[model samples]
Target: MAMPVSDPGRTRVVVTGLGAVSPLGPDLVSTWEAVQSTRPCVEPIPEAWEAFWKPKSRFWAPLPKEWIQCPLLAPLEPKQLDPVSILALESARQACSGGAPAGRGGVFVGTGSGGGASRFENHLNHLFPQKEFLPGRRGGRFNPFCIAMGMPNSPAAMISIKLSIEGPCRTFSSSCASGTVAIGQAAQAIRSGEVEWAVAGGAEYLVDPDGTQFHGFDVASTLTRIPTREECNRPFDAGRSGFLFAAGGAAMLRLESERSARERGAAILATLDGVAENCDAYSPMAPAPTGERIQQCALEALADAGLLATDVDCINAHGTGTEANDRIEAAMLERVFGRGPKVTTTKALTGHLIGAGGALEAVFCVQGLLDQIVPGMPNLVDPIADLDFVLRTQASEHRNVLKLSFGFGGHNVALVFTKAGTP
Candidate 1:
């Protein structure tokens, strides 16, 4: 299977549509509005926290139940829809509605801890003291579809099926970097002439009590038991503790170019100039603290776009609020830009959406270009180092934005986006 490469000058990737299902909102417009306002989407645990690992952290960004209603799951009863399926469908539908091209469209979605909550819930039910010992009870096979929907690739498959995307369909699960990797792959496919259009994004829905317990046990999350959402996530701030857990989905459509989208009368959202992905191979959970690989990723992406660091006016950082991540990312940007660009972390507003974070933040980058505004870090009261973090107020002047994402498995991805009219 050889991939056909187009003339280097023949193909150009562009963003024609965008979609999102986040704690901030269910769709792109709403989410962008929420981001501009610096709203805090984190909240206290919906149910009894005691049931989930002694309530080390009482807050998280959980999506609403109604936010998942989508056309993809119309065949299934509402109660039967898994959270992951709901997220994927919602994101896909929104993207499709926004002008995904007809015949040649494809799908690629990223996910982490797919359907973990459903599996945990089923296991707990089977373990009940008075449970009947049915034939499948021990193995907990009551819902056969559970496993089908729980697989990491389920989101991509479901989106493909729902959208009737008969072309390439795939899923990436590189921890938090999954979304950006998925989008980067989609863009590469288009550039290689493999597909004309693609629905690319990521989803996450692991907010169940037992699922929270597992995360607590992992000790990777920031256990800040703040009573209010405003204080939960503080990216690039000295007071920042760790990454806040969040759940949601995000999607975008990668088209061949504006000419192709215009031929179909599709609404052009933004220009996807270039994307680059690399791995540090340094550590499984931690990034190469020197930030060399990620810096290279940024440099590579800028070169792909034929642009310079000075040309980038803003950057959507992978600021996870974790000490190591924020510091490393800050230093990397400083080294690359000499002085860091106007930087912000949406994770402070939406918490960290794990695999979905990068895709969702990429959407924010597009919005920044389109709306001429860059979101601010919501609660970063105390500054860290000498970086210029847009805090509490959105920036109104941004032409080119760089979106960066790093994952636990040493994955790093950078996307460069220019304004619609930019050369």
Candidate 2:
């Protein structure tokens, strides 16, 4: 069933702020520089994790520990909150900091690793007391607030509590596409007159002290088996092996109605032109070989924005670096735009953030428009498709950007963004 969307004539939504905690750096500025440089953040998987099991993949893109210790970010003690909630709370803090709390604001956040920290810690400890199943930690005790912290909605609720958002608060759990869906839903609410502004994005910290996530993905043969960290991160390349699994991180965008932002004298960064989401019932973990649904999603998003295929100048593709995914997505983009738009894959730099990947890419899309450049991919040695991949940072006056994200469970979401000051 279709949800009721707002009349485009009534309200228009725009982005006013952006925040992120990424493997490349702690804040948006530092990370953007690293991103522009095409720096790969993968590292040798620490030997400490070997106590549990040996893995097929040798490198991991773990979130920087220093970022978590940054002051005055999280709403509560960092230890009390799971890494997922902490990442979300910190990004939300940064996004909602300067402005006065939005009395009628809503909170929409997404997370795929809500089960990583508190969930495992509490449950494993209860089942086996004094057993050091997880490295650097003993599983002998449990906390009273374990249940609350482990809840998937904890990240969204924490943001609402910290920022005093008084409207509908929701946590989207669409796996890798979670962040994109959250931001899209928030934009819909504003356009529909349900909220004045909303904090929307996603965070993930799947690295457990015990190595649960590593073993699972590695064993499934979906992680990069390349020997060197530098060689392992490749997107849209003929030799692309698999995605670089990041430890965790978060990214958030503060979206407001155009009128509210103008009245408050807020600096508008980008116009949220349109958004659309759908599911591919074809598979639970793989996109259909026909590639019909993914293509339809992109076209639908443009229609929602009242735009045509020729209007878009760039594409922020959900390039996971996996052979199957890259081939499928390339086919879809080619069939739709036919090598017209500059397709950029950011996973080469940030790795596969899973839940947080989409939100971070959205932030990059806004940043790219502001800088008037598209990020390059030096790691992709051979072209996998005919699409125009930005091989190096190139200056451009491109306005409209399409950000696409597809999750494992066939969740497909597309969002269209226009440069600020565009009619």
Candidate 3:
């Protein structure tokens, strides 16, 4: 259900801070520059991982190793926490660093699979060894804390604890749309007066050391097996094969009510105009062919923002390179915006982060607005549909943007944003 906006004058939600550990870079500035330049960060999968899984997808956008060494993460014991929690903690640290820590606010994070859960499962498999036990076997060798660490709520809880946020803390796990849904829910909470502010975003690190888990996508034939790293991940291109699975990262934004932001003199990066979420109810892993529900979601988000479709100046599309997704999303965009606004997807550079995709792309939208420059779709040599694709960096006076996210369960979400001063 859409969140109830009780009072239009209650408080407008605005983004004050942003933090990210992405394939493009370790920080926000570097990542934004990479996007604007259409830089390619994909490289051959690390040799360590190749030794085990021999995955079909040879290339992926892996984050820098040094990005995780943040001072805010110093308090936690590294081995005890999963990489998911660590990534979220580091990103939240960046988002909350300089001033805006709403003690009474909430923490909301979206993720598909908890790293700790997968970690626990991997170890459990070894510990149990085919679900058999020797006679007189005493207590298993598995780590006792696995249960607590593996819970989906671990990241949210750790963020709340690290930042001392006392308000409602929640996690959304709606597949790939999880992060966007978490951000939407946080904005709703602010509008509903549930809290004055929130730490909202998504995090995911699905690169398993053993490499056994990612083989599922390979077996399903949903991952690209291109020979060269430079030649893959061409979103919207005619030669596109499939999504390039990669090492996932985390991104977070400090979302606060306008009043709180102004009172604290926080630098407003962008205004979160509105967010809409719905489902296709058509298939578990495929989008509706007619693009009906996706179109409805776009309209609903624009309506919530009190604007018409024409007002959207740009669209940060959910343009995964996969054939079905690209075509369906193109159809949906054509139906919604009529090829009027410029469209681009940063996934060409970031790979498919799955859970963290929406959050990182939303960050790109805000950064683009601040700079008035839209990043182009990297490696897009051919068009699959009738749409205006930004193939190179372009400057614009545009103020409003629509960021769309769709997940495997047909979950759809649209977030409308505007420049800080836009009404």
Candidate 4:
């Protein structure tokens, strides 16, 4: 039977919990503190990295080797925790710390290049000239687990199984915009009363040798010869080059407004006032230079929140450190904020998390609302536009914020998160 439609006045959505497994840190607190300090997380690829790629890029940010030691992850074998799975599990575990409500709750996660490393490595092992291919080799049928682990939807499936969640489960993959779109879709579901709670976020692990070769061949990664990871990505700087590659995950709990959260006594992190998504349909790999769709998406989100451009206090920019993205994003902000509000790009610190960028940026925006502070952009010495780019230090106060993310295939998403009880 079809479910009943939600009464427009009946349900409201708000953020009740948050989590992250990022280059900056494993959890929200640690990640936020590291971001505030502008600590660079990028590093030289490990020795094993060569097995994955040739003519390699300069730097990438891989999770610390110690993350597998966390008590929450003790259930799984160390080899089982591939980068994508590790990020998904860690972020979901943190987000659901308070426990999702007893009834149906949804799970949505986005990922780009899901588990490509594991699949590629397994393939090469069998295909090499010296190696023999056999049906029963090692774990029979080449271990169906590889496809299961590498599947983009595996993260959401794993999260649902781990948490025993009995409601909707979905995995969205729209190139780089996958994560943000997941959150937006989850919010819509809750607001429309499809579910009581939703776990939403994105994860990625694309720094592997196979992953790098694919991305570098596509000419999407920064090719700088810089020795240090810190100098690899320079978003919005006049001397900006391109985005540094990185891997990470972020997730958040969305509940039906303050009333439901307070009724269940869940901690209210922030309010997700509005969200909007748009597609340019112009190009699959690049955004339109005029940024018309991006501007439209932002305006729609602000309108959904019942606010004007001047009402937003800060912006989490989708600054990918690429020339086309930064310039187009700057134009969009100028069109919407009339010079743009206080803006910062966490990508400067975390690098681009691809499908995970949107959800992580959403978490950052929520943090800006809850902590009343805005994190700064790193390596942005010269301004690219007339906008106020938060730099060097974090902002002292932020009440309302807009988080924007644009991805390949011209996917644009904007989310407006307001302080609790804001009019």
Candidate 5:
């Protein structure tokens, strides 16, 4: 379908509500608190997982069991649904819980590795007859919902059904940049007058007990074996090795047109002023060495928002704790915003959420705008570059902020945000 024209000033997009289920915590408040305190959310691989796959990276970030006590998720049948879909549903519930006014909106979700984990393992067990690995059902009869639950678009479809969203429900799969792209597209949908609101974000449940799944990254030599949280992942730090795998998580935002929000007296969280996406076309899994395309993405996004780089007070970086990624990202920020806006990466806290990385970082950016404080990087011991790193939580009167996300296959995305009603 052709998108409606996004004529600036005619249809403005604003975020009214936010929700998340992360390794640090289940909901937004807990996640924010954990971020502020620089708490390490990564943990040693669970014993249950140890019985199956022996990941090169022995540490992972899994959601606390207590945080899953969401009333909205109680009705879900875990046997029939994928954990990715469940996480998305719960996050969307919390985001729309504020009773914000909405219209015939839609659901947009971003995920890098979509489903098929447990099902694939079960199928393999049936073929291999393994006693230790995934135990297949006696009849070889998989759950009826396996296909539906594993599709990349499953989360979006589920949210649309549960929320009665009859608009254009869609899913975006751009590797790790999936969630950020979904959010950017959803905001465009509202700005183009296609919907009054959109429930959009990203989620991922890639880590599983299946070695078949973890082996790919393991062989790629990207997996780091930092078993202890204190020693594990450090974003943009000189001592950084690589990102530790993180838990399946989701973050949903209630995005609405400014006109629709005011008409319904919705409490505005922040304005999603602009979004831009581009590709490096350099390599499938590596970023462009020059960092030129990534810089262009940020510049275009700021221009779309009718703002200058100086207007951006803070930036939520896509710091993956890998040597190449941190180096390129640090250089990109230095080139784009100079030694100006405060910079920090949430991966040090939440590990790498993959598809949800951008969306979750966006959550932090919105909250930073509202709270007027920049959250600090947890394990950033020595700066990789001369950029202004937010070493500790500090108060600021920031009005505009930028969220950056990059994915494998050379996808890069940037979103610009401002305090609601910023003139």
Candidate 6:
């Protein structure tokens, strides 16, 4: 048997650098170190998202305030950049720390709630100048950069602007799967010879001053709630309720062709082997109850990676700690991998960064491949399915891994990551 050699563009894509600013920690080292704990780092939110009419979210995991305070980000005046954009810039700066000359490459970022902090909220303040209703001036006009600050593509725009990157700068807003899809899209661009390098990841900031973002998810019944402040986000547990939404954070990866990395003498972190996306198109809210589309998506992803289900050794499950999603995702995993792949979820510690959650999890997956470790599910008590879940942080050699993410409107994505030097 013979195999044809592939060109440089289609040869291989490696993650040369990784950066993340999460509630778990500031940089990748701290984040990985924090996961060694058996419990999550979730914290009680201040004031519990007080709205006069609706319920407020009590649990959240937000990055440290000191990292993004106005004084720290001097010269970037207030209202000129949304929190999501600021977070994106920070993460991208960390990933591109190798100082890749800025003239080339692309920037792709994802944010599910990037627009919530827009002037539209101010317009609401102008109309309803009542206290405890909206958190804004009685009747003040917004700054001129209102639209630019809160645009869905603002994160990507900020990354390019700060890093001086040129090429196809784009953003993915496909709900929760946005970050994973953005990375996939960036890999596609390199495969198609569109660029030699790219910045791909996602950032999310839902903790708007007005509590509107929390109100939206709380009204949708997706924000996870627990009876006690001592416990939170029990993903895959039999009594799981929902995901603990983040106050939000960002994660970024600097990806380049293997050839380019070698030429530049960069260290290879991991490989972006394959990716596949599908739409259940069944329901905007509920996943296909049968888990058929998600099952198909997993198979397609493995196929794209030129590997079978048997080749995958670990799954960074998008286990959001929700009842229905956990059940459906568990069932789909059994159907595809037959409970063989070790399942792990870091959402408890990460607090479901919405769009950025996937990118953060993807970073964890790469780290997992490097250390041969899978993080234990925080607060996981009773099992929902007969799957091999990593109950505590431990070492297990994983050569191939699959990361799954599903968004509202049926946006499903599966990304396959292989060990750095695997053939």
- Candidates in order, TM-scores: namely 0.90, 0.95, 0.91, 0.89, 0.92, 0.92
Best candidate, lDDT: 2
Across residues 326-388, which tens digit of lDDT does each residue of candidate 6 receive? 899988887777778899888866778889999999998998888888888757789888889
Query: What RMSD value applies to candidate 5?
Result: 3.8
**Local error of candidate 2 at 132, Å?**
4.6
Q: Of the candidates numbered 1 and 5, which has the greater lDDT value?
A: 5
Which prediction has more favorable TM-score, 3 or 5?
Answer: 5
Q: lDDT of all predictions, in order shown?
A: 0.76, 0.85, 0.82, 0.74, 0.81, 0.80
What would the TM-score be for candidate 3 when compared with the true structure? 0.91
lDDT of 4 at 185: 88
Error of 2 at 99 (Å): 1.0
- Model 1 misses residue 202 by how many Å? 0.7
- Model 1 residue runs over 4 Å out of place are 1-10, 75-80, 98-100, 125-141, 221-229
- Candidate 2 overall lDDT versus native: 0.85
The alpha-carbon deviation from the true structure for residue 215 of candidate 6, after best TM-score superposition, in angstroms, is: 1.4
Q: Report the C-alpha lDDT of model 3 over 288-398, residue by residue, as the tens digit.
A: 898888888888888788778888899999888888889888877877677789898888878888888999899888888998988887688888877889988779778
lDDT tens digits, residue span 131-182, model 4: 4443322322343366676677777877787777778999988777888888
- Order of candidates by TM-score, top first? 2, 5, 6, 3, 1, 4
Candidate 5 lDDT, tens digit per residue, 63-180?
8786544454445566666788878877888888867465768788999877746567446545655343344422344566777767888888878877677899999999889999
Candidate 3 contains a number of clashing pairs equal to: 0
Q: Summarize candidate 1's per-residue lDDT along 292-391 as a digit string, tens digits.
A: 9998898888877777887778889999888888889888887777554788888988888888999999988887788888888868888775667788
Question: How many steric clashes between backbone atoms does each model show?
Answer: 0, 0, 0, 1, 0, 0
TM-score of 1: 0.90
Rate residue 184 of model 5 by lDDT. Answer: 98
Name the regions of candidate 5 deviating beyond 4 angstroms.
1-8, 47-54, 67-70, 73-76, 100-102, 125-141
